[model samples]
Target: LPLKPTPPPFRNHGNFVVSVAELNRWLGERAEEAGAYVLSETVGAKLLVDDDYEQSGERSAGGEASGRDRNAPGRGRSTVIGVRTGDKGRDKDGGRKSNFEPGSDVVARATVLAEGCWGHLTGAALKGLGLAAKDPQVWALGVKEVWEVEQPLDRVIHTLGWPLRPQARFKEFGGSWIYPMNRPGETPRVSIGFVVGLDYADARLSVHDVLQEFKLHPLVRKILTGGKRVAWGAKAIPEGGYWAMPRLHAPGMVICGDGGGMVNVPKLKGIHYAIRSGMLAAETLYSSLKAGSTDFSSYERAVHQSEIGKDLYESRNMKQPFGRGLIVGGAITNAMVVTKGRLPGGHWPTHRDSDQPLLLTDRDKRYPKPDGKYTFDKLSSVFTTGNATRDDAPSHIRIQQRVPRELAEAWKWMCPAAVYEVPEDAPQGSEHVDLIVNPSNCVQCGAITAKGGRLTPPEGGDGPVYQVT
Candidate 1:
């Protein structure tokens, strides 16, 4: 690690890393074994609200399943009861194909939203149900790659500074991590990645490009001397801590995992918090059902009192100080850690990622050009993720196609999947420029959603097929 003054990392013998995708597959199998019907190749397009509920089949007048009456009482007050799966076999023009099948409503007594970071339905529920957090949720973009290294990395290594400027004016907040993937007998492998706060002020800062630059550092290059990059992907993380966590529950519904902003940024861990919150949600739902009650508010209370809430509360103001810059922010973070978040204790405010000012700095010139080996471009990076999105699939990203040149460049560099593009001959002035969107190139990282754009779910079974990430 090439950090200035070489700060000692918080090492623990209990810490270990595993393939998330593989773990998920194992969990799915266990769930199925427990009699849970796991539906594959399906997308939950939208949450089914009780006030506007509509079923797909015909009704028998005797309390049978059917579409809801639009004129029924409580039409304006809605509660999420379940989800509607996305329609399949629709052409690019949205016309029905021979095998077209309309989406069916999978109604449930209680719906739990465990959608990962920046989920589509989670955003809808937050806005439609008025589940507001005290502060707006902030985000970071993480681009990562796995490599088959020649030498095994015995332990985890984290680095700060070097690729990203540490000056207060830069407003860059992030770091890189390198971890050994396999044990003694297995092939030597390592997972290396970099994360950058989405609120960065530079108009041309690219999280992916920064990662390429980070790999070129002497300390990093030594680890990947003769290695070949295997898998690559990007994802957005919610770093707004406790104050930014939305109300965890609504009528007949509960939100869990990254969708509820349970991540503790400093520790760089959220899986445990997500798991704990999930267990509490399950208990609350079970009790509600057994008591024949419709209220799900108990779940929220349980979360606040549980370990997840306490952990987040202690680090609630951690990420906010970093908005001031790495040095001052780092100092404040250290002080807060020692004081257990009691130092400077009031709620700290945060700005939306898009609201951050994009200054016309020359930072873009510092990015390294890909050399084909250790560093690569976005298009090449996307290929390694096993992306299989159909070329003719409807666009899932929503943003103004025309915007100021500065914003255009920001989007162009911000995306790690090469989804956004500006014409090469476009004038570098204040005029609006046409931004081309290659939606098929998207890996469903959800970065756009955090940076002034919206990401809807693509057709089921499309997008990247991550196996070991």
Candidate 2:
């Protein structure tokens, strides 16, 4: 039987909240107890590869190897800078300038890169080794805002919602959280955000825009009706599952947290994976060092045996159609919901068995668009006939009349066709103008004159009534 859920003793107390300082203190105590040296505020520079360490030798492969040759120039020392005082000890600064060192001062026999989303240093090192390449397909943008609410601070509840109407499946892999840990009478704080997929290379869709749209939703707006935005920012969340992961271990180096793209999108969790990876990496390093071995293959093996790896592999398989089919299907389902006033099967759409291809060509019966025109019920397609046809005109023209008077007038005078030929020294003065917007360079206006349309000024109000050609 499944385990029973239990209610918390405190009502409206808010979700779990912990401080970084407390966490670091606990880690220091635990690590020190285990005979491990813990250093804070240290950044990992790069991997130390021993090309001379032969892999074929029986003892060198897994067993004890030679110790640090003190006589060697850069042996037996890992540098660390003192934060309070700018001084470095003998074992710390390894004959490098504070400004010259590429990364932070903290150095060790084995370093684990646990930097969250901002893992530029780790990415650089991986790219240098030819172990990984950047791909937008595996990345996602996360936008969040912290709001101060006027509602009663004692009974604040956290609410998580599915994505808005047409894009339910594209529901970003995140949550909405409200914490009531503010001072006695202070306004409550609520954090809301979404993780958007970065499949499209176009820059048209902004994460901030999506987040603003989310705040405008009826359900979300209800909670934040009287609240004011306190702070907001966007961060990248690594969404690549097993297939997108790079090498976990190399000589003297390892990666953890978002740096390794270890987020579990379905579960909306990553902190646990980050902590476990760090602990495992440290354990692997400790054992290797104690055994007097330089090889770090065991670190790789440990991660593979861990639950994080298993979950990632499973999720990768489970979320196969996430990019295309899931988004499109959600859109179609949303349309049905709006029309029928009920969700399909009276149930929330969960993950589907999506092993099939996401796209449909002429061969697929569901979407057999044999003709050149792309047909869909969502929007109607227009056709063109004459030399100056309405269908061939741009979308800006069709919407111009519906736009506000000021904007419509602006568009009318700054007709893209006319703007394309305005002189460099025309009325608007052109020092900072783009070369592409120089209207005097246009030759197509001659044809408009032949069609009895004045390209320039006319006797009527602001030139002839321009027809959207």
Candidate 3:
């Protein structure tokens, strides 16, 4: 990342590369040392908002309903008082688990959402607060693996272009990354991954297939020639920059990190910003809550005045033009890249990624199936994650009753978990494609939910359990 686009001395070389497990473990240790009463394996069941408008007999300064309108949570600037924790051992199949108990509320002065991308309660909270993203948020699905290689490389690498069809048109903005991992005294290894924009227009674009094809490229195959694969997983990323950010302060809550779309698209970084934002929130809370003040706007203003917002504002226009085409997007991106973001001053309005057309009219697409040794299929890859979702849990995903066949087919390809599929027994050439949902296969990446499916939070501890370094 360069600092020229930014006005002053905020240029950062790059972040130290480390495993997510290791990073989280370190943070957890530090947090405990600082006197935080940390809770594990608990999900925020629901945000608690106040309901005391009648006593005040008032509204917002402009005659809008004051923060306690029970009718519409998304309006009236509701303050989030706290969150209700999901019940332990809770399952939709009533009385199925022996130790079942209903959820309980935990009231607090403030709440912070760093729930990663497409979190279940994020949209609900934003709507409840009556705020919306200026431009729709767009996203991409990243599939990755850790490998112990036969031959070791000592450097980091990034590559774009090729192995992708023109319909997706993500060449200029997103691609593959291969970063070497260093261990105290072990065989040399690397973490490899491919990020394919989820906004792809084809119903045939499978994220696993995209990563598998990326491995076959001449440049990549040489490095992984005889490497042994060790692990696999997938996630979604927010790409829309500054303009896509919604109002940050809720009545009693604030959001940080990727869940708030604070990632810098050009640099493919957000960790530092997340840490900074969290610190800023802490300082504000220390002063405000300690003084018994109800204001939360200070946190938002600090963010806008800090390096995070300036950097985001400077390159605000980078990602959206690609919605038109790579060529058009490329010319604009190239000029900015070459000039350090001085070429653009405004952002374009792009529809939400899901709102884009679901299918390409001229369908002529084929993906090379996995060959086991070097690359494998989705189900097998997910097995490597060791995700053990309950076999008897009820379907937490809800799909509209009469979705068109084309849209249904689109969902089948869009989800990397294989949670969605069409019936194999359908007649040879019939347009009747019945959507089958395998809730057990869901890793809860939230991709299916982003693409028109409604995702209600499942029982606490029902999703994949990733390691904390």
* All candidates: TM-score: 0.92, 0.50, 0.88
RMSD per prediction, one decimal?
6.4, 21.1, 5.9
Best by lDDT: 1
lDDT of model 1, residue 389: 88
lDDT of each: 0.81, 0.41, 0.69
Query: Which scores better on TM-score, 1 or 2?
Result: 1
lDDT of 1 by residue, 134-242 (tens): 4777889999999999988888888766688888777899998898898778779999999998998888899999999888888889999899998888999999888
Mark the regions of model 1 whose C-alpha exceeds 4 Å error after superposition.
Answer: 1-9, 52-77
TM-score of the candidate numbered 3?
A: 0.88
lDDT for model 3, on a 0 to 1 scale? 0.69
* Evaluation by TM-score, superior candidate among 2 and 3: 3
- For residues 419-453, write the lDDT of model 3, one tens digit per residue: 87777775656655677788878777777655666
* TM-score, cand. 1: 0.92
